[model samples]
Target: MDRLTNPIRPYAWGSTTAIPALLGVEPTGEPQAEMWMGAHPGAPSRVDRGAGEVPLSEVIAADPEGELGAAAVAKFGPALPFLFKILAAGAPLSLQVHPDLARAKEGFEDEERRGVPIDAGHRNYKDPNHKPELICALTHFDGLCGFRPPLEAADLLEGLGVDSLKPYVDLLRAHPVDAALREVLTAVLTADRAEMARTVADAAAAAERLGGPYAPYAGLVHHFPGDPGVIAAMLLNHVRLQPGEAMFLGAGVPHAYLDGLGVEIMANSDNVLRCGLTPKHVDVPELLEVVVFEPGEPAILRPEDEGEEVYETPIDEFRLSRYVLAPGAAPHSLPDTAPQILLCTAGRPRAGELTLAPGESVFVPAGETAVLSGAGTVFRATVVV
Candidate 1:
């Protein structure tokens, strides 16, 4: 096991103090958006060996079979299949969707063939793998995920009584859920800029007048005034998750984190096709192609208790589980087969010879066994071998 030092991404929408408070460090005053703990090439965590520090990526590259286990190396090649992150959102993130593996590979190869620079702002695919993620709330977390049922959205729009939204309402009421959602989203994304701005203003006003479920739309307008994403936000489900609660976002699902902090784990890829609510590139055609327009309730994941609370998902790339150790509790054995990233979120926990405080993490190599004890809450991220 090696203590890991990770970089914090300072995105504009990040909170100034949320990550600092969690790590028990003084605020840097700069926005700290995400603390990435993995061997992803973008920001690989540093592992402190006895003699010196080394990039985890380099370490894995030196001996893929020993570091990543033979099975993982054979299945996913010589790289970590999952990326773990501590995501803090003081403001909203971009409205985005991730492609499936097939689409991702096609987009990445196409862009490469077109001679687009890998670091270009307009480059959509950063990798050739799909990203399916799960975020477990560490604080009160709010987000927009997937699309709500068309009938429900229609009722909300009808209650707003905005003349501009009447067309959407009529479409929703007249068509089936999938067709209604597809058409409404298409219209919102492709609408004329001036006309969309007018519609947003009117919708914001209407949201203010009718203050029940429509209130969040007004808030969205405030955050991104005149942005077409404000109108797009009206189509998705608004989710608020308490601590310990989680949401799984699958491939082709559109989502954006609205506020608060969470422990997020996903496939190690960055192939995002954004639609709106960001200063970054927005490829409307690609986004439309990647997004799943089916309407339904967001799947709020609740961990299953079995000594540890397991947060299950469909993918085999990552498996996240949480352990809460009370004072005087017996030590628990860490998984001995797979490479794991153990993160201490609360209190001080001792694992083998290392002690971890809040926001501290360790990288446990495959074939290693360690016992965890003392009082704290720890989350374990490992591949599902």
Candidate 2:
């Protein structure tokens, strides 16, 4: 097996310290957040194929079906179709949605036919597949996912005592999900500046009065004062996952990665439609068109009690499972399937003879028998047939 070198993605929302600390490097004061370990074209991991730093794409091309397995090649075509990440969000990410597979394919092909550069900053769709993602929390991860039941939103809004927000609270109490969401979001996104500013000020005061851990929500109000997302956040379900917990996001789910480190796996697509809480492109009408507006709680995924420790999500592109190794525990054998990526989230562990520390990961190709011993917890990412 060739020792592969992973790629680090420098994104503005990334934590300056989290990933750098794991890599034993001094912080460059830049936000170095995601360390990608698979062969997704955006930031394909480098493989030392001989003496040069060749992209993993070249290595897989030499023997497409053999190296990546027939199942992967047939599904993804000539390259690794999944992207694996160690994502650390220092601040909240923009509320965004990904288009469905049909839309993604059409958009990508149309852009390509028009001769648009794939890496152009303005490029939205990069591949033909919809991006379905699963984030397994390595720390306490908080996020806004989907829409909250209208009654709960009404209760929160009513308690806040903001007169301008009362219309929205009442709308949620009375109207159906879509109409209520459309009306409320439309009002917030296109409200009169002075009226909305006063309402936000009152809401922040109210959130502070009814405070606990949620008191911090007011700080977010302070951080992006008058930003519509702060108000929009009230309308969505607030979910937090402890370490070892997981959440799945399919196409059209309005969600944001709030904070903390996580091992994330997603279908290789890179399309994103932003709603708010960012300085990046905001295609509000496009986002409004694609979002699933049913008012409900976020679905927290639990692993099925199979003989194997498996954390199953609601997608087909990738499946993430974790094995927490205790001191002196016997070596655990992993699921033998198509190509898999194994990562150590904590402690020191040995995969064959190579010792790995926290954040160190290795790619286990198909048909390989990988034995784990020594120490640390490991999360395995593989494709589900």
**By TM-score, who's the top model here?**
1
Q: Write one digit per residue (lDDT tens) for candidate 1, span 122-187.
A: 999988899999999999999999998999888887787778889889898898778888888888
Q: Score every model by TM-score.
A: 0.97, 0.90
| Full-model lDDT for every candidate | 0.89, 0.78
Which residue pairs collide in model 1, if any? none
**Residue by residue across 286-373, what tens digits does model 2's lDDT show?**
6776777787777787665532357777666787787777779888776556787778878888776767788788777777767788
Question: Which has the greatest lDDT?
Answer: 1
Listed per candidate, the RMSD to the true structure in angstroms reads 1.3, 2.6
What shift in Å separates residue 322 of candidate 1 from its native position after superposition? 0.2
